[model samples]
Target: MVEDGHFWTETNWVFIEVETDEGVVGVGEANWTVFRARTVVQALEDMERFAVGLNPFDVETLRQRMYNGNHFLHTPGVVQSMVIGAIEMACWDIMGKVTGQPVYNLLGGKVNDRIRSYTYMHYKWMPPEPPEKAAEAARHYVDKGFTAVKLDPVRPKEGPRNPRIDELEYAEAAVAAVREEVGNEADILIGTHGQLYTHSARRLAARLEPYDPLWFEEPVPPENFGELREVVDSTSIPVSTGERLLTVHQMAQAVENGVRIIQPNVGLTGLLEARKMAGIAQAHYAQVAPWMYAGPIAGAASVHLCAAIPNYLLQESLEGWNGFHNDILEDGLEWDNGDLIPPEKPGLGVEFDRSVLESYAGEYRPESS
Candidate 1:
C-alpha cells in the first residue's frame, strides 16, 4: 500500500548518464521506492558490459539483448524493468543528442503542442486537516494554473485502522470540498492506494459520483485483474491503475479488462515500452498518463512521450517542483498554464550535472563487506 509520499519525496531518485565518444552525454532515471534506489544504482553499475559500446540508435536491439541476454531478468518487474528502462532511456537520450532532434520528434512528432499536466496533494499537506484542507490545497494548485489534482483520503486497511464508515466520510468531504472550490473547470482524481474491498469500494464510488471525479485510482490492489474488472464494471467513476504493474502484458490485460486510463512510468517501463503500452491503451480507446516520482529526467521523458501520444490525457508532476531534480539539469522542464511545452533542444533536451550526482554517491549503494 504505497502512498503519495513515496512519489513526493526527493531523496530517492536514481539518475543514469550515458556519455558518447564524441563528448555528448544523455540522461535517464530509475524511479522506485527509497529503499530500492541503492539497488538500482548497483544494477546500473552491473550493466556497463551491455551498455558500454552499444549504438545509441539501436535501442530496440539493445533492449532485446538486455532482456534476453540476462538469464535471470527475462520478465519485467521493479528491479529488471527499472534497469532496462534506465538503459533504454539513456539510449534514446543519446540518439536525440546525435541527431539534433527532440526525442518526441523521433517518436513521431507531436499530436498536440502542449501536453496537459496534473499534480497530487495529500489531504493534510497544508493546513493539516483531513477534509477541511482539501479544498484549500486544491485551490492552491488551481491558483497556480493547474487544472487537475489527485488525492487519496482512504487509508489502506493494512494499517490496522479500518474505520470504513469514517474513512468514507473523510474521503467524501475532501472530494466534495475540492469540487466545491474548483468547480467543473478542473478535474478531480480520487486515489485510494489500492486499499478498500471492491464491494465497499463500489459503494464508495457511487457516493463520490456526485462530485464527478475524473477516476478512482487503484481502489483495490492491482493484481486481481478479474476482481479489478468487476470493480470497474460496477463503478460509474472510471477506474485507473498501473503504477505497480511492471510489464506491457500486465498493462494490456488491465486495459482489456476495462481500465480507462493506463499509467506507465518511464522509470518502470522505459520510454519505448511505455510508448508501446500507450499504443495498447490507444487501441482500446484509453489514454496514457505517465506517472513519475523520479527526478526531472523522468519528468522530461514523460513530456516527450506525451507529445507524440494521441491519446495522452495528462502528465503527472510533483507539486513542489523539487530543486533536487532541477538543479541537475540546465533546461529541466517548465510549465505554462497547466501544460508542458516540448523543448526544441535535441536528445531528451536536458543536461546532466555530475557534481550534484557525486555529492550523494555514498547513498547510492551500500558498502560491500
Candidate 2:
C-alpha cells in the first residue's frame, strides 16, 4: 500500500510478490517516478495472464512471451518493460536462491573486479556556488578515494531563463575551478544539463574541451537529435547522455547520431533491455556509462548490468557522507577506492531497510489526497 498519498517524487515503490504452490514467494520492485508508478502497476496487472501459472525458471520464454504478448507496450520503451522487468529481476533472484549462485554469476559471471563509479555535483540542493568551492568539494571526494566525478556546470539559480546569458559566467567559473582542483588526473564528467541552445551548446562544449573531461553530457538535451548531432560534430570531447531516454530505438538513434558515450538508467531502461541497448552501442563502438540517481538497490542493479556488458565504461556514484545517503539503504555498498562489489546476492542482490523507507516516506500532497 502507498503509505503516502500517491507516488510522485517521494521514495515510493511498487513491489511484486510472486507466490508459488510450494509457498515460495519471490519479491521484486519497480520503483519509478510518482507518475509512472500507476503505469507499471497497470502493466503488471494486464501482463499477469501469461505470468501467474508459468514456470518462473523459464525466464527467457517468459520474457519473450511478455514482450511478444504485449508487443505494442514493450516496443516503445520501459513502460511495459518495467512490468516485465520486475518479474525478470524476481525470477533471477529466485533462480539464484535455488542454484546458490550470485545474480552476476547467472548473467555470465563477472568481467571486472568491481564496478567503477562517479558522483554527481549540482544535483538540485547541491547547486553550483563557485568554481573554487566546487573544486574544493571535488578534492574532498578524491581524498575519500573516489577516482571519478561528474558536475553540471550550468544551472538557473533563480528560475527559468528567458534566452539570456545569465548564469553563463558562473557556469564557466565553476567548471574551471573543478578542473583546477582535479588537475587533469581525475575522471571528470561535465554535464551541461541539456539547458543550452544549439549554438550555445557547441560553444560550451568547446570551452570545457581543454579540461579533458571524461565526457560532456546532455549538452543540447534529447528532444532534437539534430541539435545533439550539431554539438557532437563541433566538439572533439566525448559526449555522454540518455538518462531521460529509455528504449533501444532511442539509443539506436543516439548512437546513429554519433554520441560517443551512452548513459541509460537501469531503473528506467529495464534490466534486459539495457543489456540490449549496450549491444546496440557496441555495434557503433560507443562506450556505455549507465547513470545512477536512485538508492542502493538501483545502484546494485546497475552494477550487475555493467558487470555483464563488455562496453561498460563507468557507473555514476555518490561519495557518501553521513545524513545524505545514510537513510537510503540498510548497508552501504562496499566502495574500495572507486568500485562497488556488485551485489552478489540474488536478483538485484540487495534489500532496503523498510523501516528507513517508512521514516523517509513523508506526506502526500496530491489534489485527490
Candidate 3:
C-alpha cells in the first residue's frame, strides 16, 4: 500500500499479489479510503484460508467461497467488496496468463480496439472563484487530445446539505466558463461527489443544464435510489452514478430507477462482477463507464472489462496515466492521443516494478498466531 498525496484525504492504494506454485503471479488493487489500507490488508489476510489452494481458473467458485463463506460478514459494502474484488481480480489475471491471452479475451473478446477515457481537472485548478481557471484546466486536457474532462465544481466541505445560492452560482459560472472555452470541441462531465441533498442536486442540475455537460455524476448521496431517480427525472443532462455502489443488485436498483449510465469501480466490483454489472445495464439499454480512482492495477482491470462489454461508454483516467502510475507499472498503460490501447500481452497486460512497489509498501503485521 502507498500513501496517496494527490488528494486531501489520508488515503492509501492497496494492491494484491496472488502468486501460484508454478511461478505465475497476478496483481489487483482494492479501493482505498482514509486510513483503510491496513483494514483491507487485514480482511485479505482473513480471507486467505478461503482463497489459498483454490484453482485460480475457477473464478466464480472462488468468488462464491470468499463472498458466501463469510456469511454475515459478506454484506455488500466497501471493505468486503474491496477484499473480494482484489482477490477475484488477481485470479482473472492468473487465468489470463495461464491461457496466454489478455483478460479481455478471457471475459469474451474485445469489442473496442481502443478505449476512450476522461480525466478530472485537478481540484486546485477548479477554484469556485474566477471560473476561468476551470476553463484553463479543461483546455489543457483538450489540447492534450482528451475529448472529455470531469470536475466537481461545488465541493462544499460539509454536505449531504444543500449548497447556498452563491455557491450554486459559482458552479454555474464554472461550467459556463468551461463550455465557453471548450465549445463543442470536447465534452464536460460534472462530478458532485454526492455532497448535496436531492433538492439541491436538482437545483444545481437546473443551473448546469444550459451548459450541456456530458453527464451529472452522483448529485446526491448514493444511499437512496428514490432520490437519485428524482434527480434523474429532474435533469435534461444525463445522470450518471454507481461509483459508490458495491454490488450488481445495487446497480440494478439504479438502472431500474432510470439511470442510463452506470459507473462501477472494478477495484471494488472485480472484473467478473463488473462484467456482470455491465450485462445488467446492457439489458436496460444503459452504458457502463468503469470508475478509476484507485491504482493502475484496478485501472487495467477496468480497461479489460470495458474492452469486452458491448455497452461500454468510457473509462475514467488519472491525468493520462502518468506520474507515479508510470513509475510503478512496467510500461504503463499505452495512451495515444486520448484513447488507451488495449494490451495484447497476457494477463492484465501490466506489471509492477518490484523496486518501486517495495519503496511504497507499508509494513503489514499479521495477528498473533
Candidate 4:
C-alpha cells in the first residue's frame, strides 16, 4: 500500500491472454466490478475448459455454443457476460492475428469514418467553490479541443437528501451555469448513475432540458425496465442508459421500452457481447452510446465496437487521466474534435505493456478470486 501510497479504488484491469497451437496469442479483459468477483473468476476458469483447444478465429460460433450450453452460470448477469466477453474478444484477437486484420474489419466495417469521444470528469473535482467552478472546468475542456463532456450531476447517493424537487432545482442551476460557460456547441451528457428515483429523475430531466444536453443518462436506476421507460416517457430529453445491463436480452428490453441510446461497457460484457447488445439496439432503430469507464484496453475495445456498430452514437472517453492507462496497455488513442481513432494494428491494435503493467501491478492484481 505504501508503494503506491493508498489502494486505487477502480484500477482493476484483468486481461486474459489465450495462446494458440500456432504460437499466436489473443488478449481479452473481464471487468468484475458488476458481479461477485469469485463467481466471475471461476466462470472464466470454466470457460477456459471449452476454449483451450477451439479455433479462436470463429468468434460467433464459440459464443453461441457457450450461450446454449445448459450451465448454471448461463443465467443472465455479469458473470456469464464476463465469461462470454473474455472468450469472444480473445477469439477476435486470434482471428486478427491469423488474418492480419484489425478487429474492426472482422465485425463488418466501420460505420462512421471517425469515432466521436467525450471525457468523464469528476464533478467534485471542479473546485466545489460554486456552480461557476464546474463551468470553469467545462470551458477548460472545451478549450483543449474536446467536443463533449459527461458528469454525474446528481449527488452520489442512494436516496434524496432533501425534497426531490429542491434537488432538481439545484441541479438545474448548476447545469445551466455550466452550459452558459461551455456554450451551445459543446455537448453535455448528464448522468444520474442509476441513483435517482422516478419522480426525482423526471424533475431533474425537466430542469436539464433547457441546457439541451446530448442525453439524460440513467435517470432512474436500471432495475425495472418499466421505471426506465417511465422516466423516458415523462421527460422530453432523450433518455440513455444500460451500462449496468450485461446481456442482449436486457438490452432488448431497454430498447423496447424506448431507450434512445444503449451504453454497453466492453469491460463488463467483453467486446463482442457489447457489439451484440449494440446490434440488438440497432434493430430497434435505437442508437448505441457505448459505456467505457476503465483504462485504455477497455477504451480501445469500446472504440472498435463503436466503429463496427451501425447505430453508434457518441462514445465515452477518459481524456485527462494521464499515465493511468499506460499501466496495463502499450498503446493509446488519439481524439480529434470528438472522435476516438483506435490505432490500426493486428489483434485489438495494441499489446500489453508488461513494464507498465508491473508498475501498476498492485492495482492490476486480481480481485476476482
Candidate 5:
C-alpha cells in the first residue's frame, strides 16, 4: 500500500563479504529502499558465477562482467545496480587492503580533506511538523552547525492525488518559516517527493525562489525526463536529481538534460562508475553530491568517492541514526560542524563489526512479512 513519502530509510540490506586467501575480508552493502533485500541477495549470489576466480585487483573487468552477464537484470531499476555495486565496493575494499592505501588515495588522492554533510529536517515515518515547528527544527539544525538542510513542505502523496490550493498555502508557509528562522546561516534545500506535476512544480518553485534555496530536488519524478527538463528550465534555482537513476549512461542523460547536480548513491552506482560520472560531470562544470541513506559502509564508500572528486558538493546523511549506525562499524564516521572527515586507513576506511550482521538480522527478513 502507498503511504507517506519522506526520506526515511528502510534497513533491509544485502551485504557482501569478499574474503581473500590471506584472511582479509572486505565489507560492502547493497541497500534496497524500494525492493526486497533477499531478492537482491539472491541476485548477488547468482552474480558469484561470473565473479568467482576473476582477479580481484582488476575490478573493472569483473564490474563490467557482472553488469553484462545477466541480460534479465539490465537497467530496469536499482536491483541490478545494487547487486553489482555491492561486489564492486568489496573489490575496492580488497584493492585497498592489498595496496596498503586508502580507497581515496588509490583513486589518485583527495581533492578535499573533509566532505560537507547535508541532511533532511523531517524524514519518512515521522509525523509531519507544522510550519512553526518546521522553522524551529531548521533553527536547531543550524545551531548544531549544519549549514545545509533539506525538507519537503508538500503534503503526503497518499493524501491527495493532485495539488490542493490549501496545500500550496501550507508549502509556502513552511519555506517562509524556515527561511525566516535560519536567515542566511544555512542553505534550505526544497525537496519534492517527485509528487508535483509540471505546473504545480513551477508554482512551488516560483514561490520558493525569493527565499534562495541551494537547489530544488526532483520536483518532478525521475522517469519523466521531459517534465524534469521543464522544471529545470523554469527555475534559476539549480535543479538536482538521479538517486533513482542507475549507471553512468542514465546520469549522463540527466546532466545533458540540464540537471546541475547529480546525486549518485554509492551503493547503487558503486565507486568506479560514480568516479567516472564525477569526472564526466566536472568536465561539464556540474557537481556530484553522493546521495546515501544506507549503512555506514555505503556512507564510507561515498566519502572516499567525494574526497577524490574535485567537483564534489554536499553528501546526504541520515540525521538521527548516526549513533546506532556508527555502533555497527568498528571505526564509524562522525559529523563535526556538518562535515565528515574522511579516514586515511586502508580501503574505504570502514570495517564492519561482523556481529552487526547477526544483531540486525531482522532487516534481512522477507518484505511480505
Candidate 6:
C-alpha cells in the first residue's frame, strides 16, 4: 500500500504485482475499501497460496480457486472479490505481456478506439455550497471539453433514510443551476451514493427530471434489489447501479430487476467477471459504464474493458486523469478533449514508474526486503 495525500483524504493505494518464472511482472490495483487498505493487503496475502502455481492464461480457474477454493470464507463480499480481482487483473497483464498483445485484444478486440469519460465536480463545490457555486464548477469541466459531469447534491447527514424537504429542494436547485450553466452542451449525472430510501430516491429523481440528467446513480442503497426496482419504477430518469455489487450474480439481479445501466468497477470485479457482467447487461439491452475511484492501474484496466465492450456507455475519470495519476504511470493515460485513448502497447499498456511508486510506498510493502 502507498500513502498519497493528493486526493480529498490521505488515501492508500493497494496494488498487486505478479511475476512469472519467465521474469514477466504484471501489476494490478485493489484499493477498494474506503479506509481499510491494510486489511485488503492481509487478505491478498492469505489468498496468495491459491495463485502461486497457477498459469496466467487460466484466469477463470484462478478466480474459481480463490473464490470457491476457500470453503471457510467463500461468501463473496467486496474484500474477497477485490483480492481475486486484483490477482486476476495481474494474470491478464501477464498473459498480454507473454503474447505481445494488449489486454483488450485478448478479451475480444476493440469495439471503441476512444472511450468517452466524465468526472465529478470539484470538491470545493460539494453540497452546502450554493447553487451558483455548483454552476461555476459545472462550467469548469464543460469548458475543459467534458461532455458529462456528476454530482451528489443530496447528502444524508446521518445513515441511509428518507431525505428531508430542504435536502430535496437543494438537490433540485443544484441540478438546475448546473443545467443552466452548461446548457445542452453536457449531460448532468446525479449520484446519490446509495444514501437514500426508495421513496426519497424517487422524490429526488422527480425533482431532477426537468433538468434531464443522463442517469440517477445508486439512488438507494445497493443491498435491496426490490427497493432498487421501486426507485427505477418511480423515476423517468434511467437508474444505474453496481459499483458496490461484488459479483456477476448481483449485477445480473440488478439488471434483471430494471436497471438499464450497469456501472461495474473493474478494480473490484476483475476484468473477466466485468466482461461477463457486460455480456449480461447486453443481453438485457443495458449499458456498461465501468466505475472508477481508485488509482490509475484500475483505470487502465477499465479503459481496456471499455474498449472491448459493445454496450459501453461512459467511463468515470478523476479530473481527466491528471495529478498523481500521471506521475505514477510511465505514460499516463492519454486524455484528449473528453475521451481517453486506449494505449496500443502490450499488457495494460502502462507501467508504474518505480521511483514514484517507491516514494509513495507506505506500511504494507509485502515484497520489500
Q: Best candidate, TM-score-wise? A: 6
Q: How close to the true structure is residue 304 of candidate 2, measured as C-alpha lDDT? A: 83
lDDT for each residue of candidate 4 in 170-223, tens digit (9 for 90 to 100): 677678878998887689889877877787777777778888998888877787
Error of 1 at 198 (Å): 1.7
Q: Estimate every model's Cα lDDT from 0 to 1.
A: 0.79, 0.71, 0.86, 0.73, 0.80, 0.89
Kindly report which residue stretches of model 6 are placed more than 4 angstroms away from their true locations once superposed. Answer: 1-6, 365-369
Of candidate 3, the 10-residue stretch with the lowest lDDT total is 1-10
Query: In candidate 6, what are the lDDT values of residues 14-58, reduced to their tens digit?
Result: 888999998999998995766778779889998899999889999
Arrange candidates, best TM-score first. Answer: 6, 3, 5, 1, 4, 2
Alpha-carbon lDDT of model 2:
0.71
RMSD of each: 3.3, 4.7, 2.7, 3.5, 3.6, 2.8
Model 1: lDDT equals 0.79
lDDT of candidate 5 at residue 248, scale 0 to 100 = 87
For residues 130-201, write the lDDT of model 5, one tens digit per residue: 789888878877887788988888966742135778888888888898899999989999888688888888
- Please provide TM-scores, in order, for all candidate models, with all chains considered together: 0.91, 0.84, 0.95, 0.89, 0.92, 0.96
Summarize candidate 3's per-residue lDDT along 89-142 as a digit string, tens digits: 998999999999999999999999999999888633755558998899899889
Winner on lDDT (1 vs 6): 6
- Model 5 off-target regions past 4 Å? 1-8, 33-35, 74-76, 123-128, 158-161, 363-369
List candidate 3 segments past 4 Å from native: 1-10, 365-369
- Report the CA-based lDDT of candidate 4 relative to the real structure: 0.73
Runs of candidate 2 exceeding 4 Å displacement = 1-11, 23-25, 35-43, 68-78, 123-128, 156-163, 321-332, 352-368
Candidate topping lDDT? 6
After TM-score superposition, the amount by which residue 1's alpha carbon in candidate 4 deviates from its true location, in angstroms, is 18
> Candidate 1 residues 100-208, lDDT tens each?
8899998988787987888887523432266667788888788888889988767544721334687678778878888998998799988777777778778789889
- How would you encode candidate 2's per-residue C-alpha lDDT over 1-369 as one tens digit per residue? 112221122445666667666765565666564666656666788788878788878877887788777556556455666677677767766676677776677767788767877776543224446567788778877777778887777764321222246556666677788778888557788876677778877777776777777888887768778778998899898877888786777888988898979998776766666888888999988999988665455566678888888888988875542243445557656777777777666555555567876676544344544
